[model samples]
Target: MTEDSAEYLQRKEFYNRMLTVYGRKPVLEVLQDNSLEIHKLHLADSNKPAAILDDMVKLAKKRGIEVCYHDKQALSRISKNSKQDQGVAADVIGKGFQSHQSFLSSNKKHYRILALDGVTNPQNVGMIIRSACASPINAIILPEKGCAKLDPLVIKASTGTLFRAPILRCKTLASCLKAFAESGADIIGLDANAPHTLGEEPLTGAKVFVLGNETEGLSSDVRAICNKHVSIPMLNNVESLNVAVTASLIAFQGAL
Candidate 1:
């Protein structure tokens, strides 16, 4: 291979990770973490933190991780949610996700899978992953579209659960569920209006718990595919639980 081509090939092996860490707390934490697989760190040149940069310089020196200094404009463009980005970003590589099948079949039934229908919020996605990993769910599934991309916030929120669990991203939620059902996994959806409560249902017999978007619940088409529709019971003024919360309740119930 040509020298430039060889250089490009070498770069591909490193997982490219990025996150907008605003304020001092998260940035300080990341700087202190030696195990973090940071590849490139982008900081605004004008708004420099002399002390923190000093630490980052020392740590990067000891570890040999590269750091990039960028202007505010560049940082803003990279951070989609511009204002919230705390002027710090890091490219920490090292997470590779396996296909859903491998994740499920591995370890022979010690875990459960939580498949999302149309969850859009990265924050919600991260929270669900955190719960899943903490609860130690086997894997997580997200449709390729409409769902949040498995990005940096998610990784940070998951606290590395994104690496631990299998995250399968199918282009279509409906088609994925259809194929999943054919594989003999019972399909269940969470809806406040559903006939059965989550605890009331039998989850131990090869199952997939589906939670939809917060506002829309399950898509009608996806809901139509389910073999069962279960819900969480809410008392008093409560109408429904958040998508992640509902999923955790059902996931824990299904745990062996």
Candidate 2:
């Protein structure tokens, strides 16, 4: 391979090991935390310098982090949430986040991952991430669209676990699950009406537990791809647990 291609591959591999934290305070928090490893710092050129921004730049410089200035549009594109990114973002190379393609390349043969389908509530997403991070679940499959964008609210709701969670981002939940199923992974959809109970699940092989939206449950497209369906056994005629609650139960199921 040419030098440029080799460099590109190296960068890509590095990026797969990182997660981008956007918003001014969140990025700053990650930077201030000495435990975290930052790959690069991005700032929008249009942002007028303030004390916080100045501190960020100085800290990044002191830490020898590569700082790149982009225009508003470019920075928004990098952060993936233009409205809430606050013209700042950083690629954090923590053990938590990764790309699905890179994650699948690992030699691990058995694992449990959580997949969100049309879950638009930031709080729910955050709680799910927190639960997954704390449990034995391998990682969360976050779709690029049709879900809540990772924002400050999500970060807050996750109790700051967003930075330390193993998250795998994909372009689409359905397509990603389909790819996983094709690769001999077990794709299980969480449905309240499913005949199978969560406790009865054997939890074998490489399994992905797909959590649907709060109200509508799984989308037809996503549900159709699941190899099986499972539900939590509830009592007292309670209709169902919140999506996040269900996530917590499923995430910890293997350990129980």
Q: TM-score per candidate, in order?
A: 0.66, 0.89
- Give the per-residue lDDT digits (tens) of candidate 2, residues 84-191: 889999988856777777788785788999999999999999999988899989999999789997777888899878878998888889889988887789899998
TM-score (C-alpha) between model 2 and the true structure: 0.89
lDDT of 1 by residue, 1-256 (tens): 6646956535433322223344334555666676566666666776656777677667766778677777888977654445655676665443434545444444353235688988988888988877776675566677767788666576576776664444565667888778768777778877889878877865456667888987988889899888988778789969888777876776566455
* Top model number, TM-score: 2
Off by over 4 Å in 2: 1-10
Show model 1 residue runs off by greater than 4 Å: 1-28, 42-50, 68-87, 93-96, 101-111, 120-124, 147-172, 175-179, 233-238, 254-256
- In order, the Cα lDDT scores of the candidates are 0.67, 0.88
Estimate candidate 2's alpha-carbon lDDT, on a 0 to 1 scale: 0.88
